[model samples]
Target: MPKSRSRHGAKPEVSPGRATLAAACASLVGIGLARFAYAPLLPAIIGAHWFAPSAAAYLGAANLVGYLAGALLTRPMASRLPAPALLRGFMLLASIAFFACSVPVSLVWFFVWRLLSGIAGGGLMVLAAPTVLPWIPQSRRGVASGVIFAGIGIGIAASGTIVPLLLQQNLALAWDGLGLLALVLTAVAWRGWPARSAPAPTLAARAKIPAHSPLPTTRLRALYVQYALNAAGLVPHMLFLVDYVARGLGQGLDSGAQYWVLFGLGAIIGPVLTGHLADRTGFGPALRLAFFIQAGAVILPALGTGTAGLILSSLVMGAFTPGIVPLVLGRVHELLAHHPSAQKQAWSTATTAFALLQAGGAYGLTYLLTATGGDYRLLFVIGACAFALGLGIDLVVGVSLSRRRFA
Candidate 1:
């Protein structure tokens, strides 16, 4: 591990735990509330006639597009903005975006706000690492990062549980309630995110690539494809799992919502469990495990959304949804470590590549789902195929990539 020291002379007042907590809250807003909240809101969003059912996917796509843009700009933005300022600013923007959804805005306006909210979510994901990582002691970084990232699951659990209940009262109130909740959380963490005076960390800058570093282009590209496949595979479940339970299984919407809640509960502990599994079995084995489990989870619902099958599927799928990324990134680091230089660039490149895949996949699948007259079952099947291919890639290319050396 690199020597732990504060950059740009950060103050001692803010404990590392506080900073990690702030990152967790930011993750809640940036991703949990801003992005994933939409899934629960989907049926209501369509029911209220905010947009046509056919256009629901496009609204979701807009957020992913903005997320890609924000990720691309993350490195540059971190350098320019203080970690706290950026965190607060983007968080406030995200909160406003949530509030804006409650109003009867035109479809175009809703799309615009969704895009803005996506940007906030992306910024939070990119910034949270640099903001929290450097502040913590070396020995605790792993655990702290896990806690911070768990904010996504926390937010998901909150949304799945709360949003359904809120929808019973009024859909607009649900949006308003979420926005208010974000504001309250932001206020609590406001002091902890590092200020302008503190050291503002940069992801690409921290690892510092050597000029003569060899490009492990093949391994890197393979990693990218694998990451993309993993993401593309999960979209159907992430976006429409609740609806699937209700419509596909002939269960009611409330039953579908309950499954979403179960998924969120699984998500909350997934990162910790995933990290432990990777430690014992290795990231490769872990990736393979996650892929297979996720595949089965997606496919089970399709084969038969029986009560037991749905519950089991929900647990496994939810656990691995947020759980897979850390393992993938860990694999990326292991591959780049041997190179000695360009590791940081490789990290940035690999994540950027994955983000693009997510964005592109969102757009493509939205179009596909709409074109097929909202054939969600077909989408899940396609997702399962994607997961199957990812498993194959890991068994073949992933194993080889781990063994090969770059000169």
Candidate 2:
């Protein structure tokens, strides 16, 4: 193990536990406050202006495209900056850009700001786990990761509830208010943030391997496939779940919103429970279970329509969807224990691939729905099959990796 030291040659007085939690919260507020918040408020924002709904959707896509770019940028930057500083800077930019969206502006301006927000959002997401994971003890890593990811659920719920309520009073005011709140949280985080000591040179040397290197080639390939498949399955839900309910199930907007509330609530519960389970069993088995549960959840909506079915599917899908990322990251962390450089490289590569897959899937599904004249059932079928395929691949790869470990 590498020796830990303070950056100033003296023991820096700071609480690792508190700092980790704060960082996680700041990251949650940073990345998600803008991205997730926008979806719920898009109708109001567009309604106040003359821009076409399609243009509004394009702006949403722009945000995702920027996220893809940010993921690419994080690869080179993560090693250069202190993780805490990187996170704070990104959060600041994102909050400001989100606030900028309050003004009724040209569609082009909205697109630009959304794209910038996406970049910052993506950077925060990629950096969040890697930054905090090092601070947590090994025994607590699973739980810690779960706690951090729960921030996403919290942020989504906050956005969903807060934005709509604020919009009821005033749309522009709502945007500015949320943005200001995020900014305040960011500043508090900056003040309390602990300084990160430099990691040992040996650890950096170990982590420097390229993605094509033989050591991580197999694991990296498997992870890419897993992420891409999962992303394909999830894109529909993230982008169109509300639309699906409203259009196919004949539910009103408020009813659709309630389904999202259930979804976010499930996300909050899912990670904590699954992380504990993973620690007890193993990541492979836990992941296999999550995949199966998620697959079932995806197909449930297609089966029937009622408040009961909608809520059931929402909870199941929500619980499993966000659970997969952290578990895979845990596996990567395990694999790269001996080689920190290799681990980081592998993570970045996989994350970038995941982002691209998510973008492609979102656009692809949107196009398909449009072409089919709002036939979401076809999309759901595709999503379910994709998830099932992911589950099968996970089982195969997981078994092979397990045997290799024992050997």
What is the number of backbone collisions in each predicted candidate, taken in the order shown? 0, 4
TM-score to native of every candidate shown: 0.87, 0.88
Mark the regions of model 2 whose C-alpha exceeds 4 Å error after superposition.
1-13, 46-50, 201-216, 247-250, 398-407
What stretches of model 1 exceed 4 Å from their correct place? 1-13, 137-139, 195-216, 338-345, 398-407
Residue 391's lDDT in candidate 2? 82
| lDDT for 70 (candidate 2) | 83
Q: Who wins the TM-score comparison?
A: 2
In model 2, residue pairs whose N, Cα or C atoms come closer than 3 Å (at least 3 residues apart or on different chains), thus clashing, are 207-340, 207-341, 207-342, 208-341
Top of the candidates by lDDT? 1
**CA lDDT scores, all candidates in order:** 0.75, 0.71
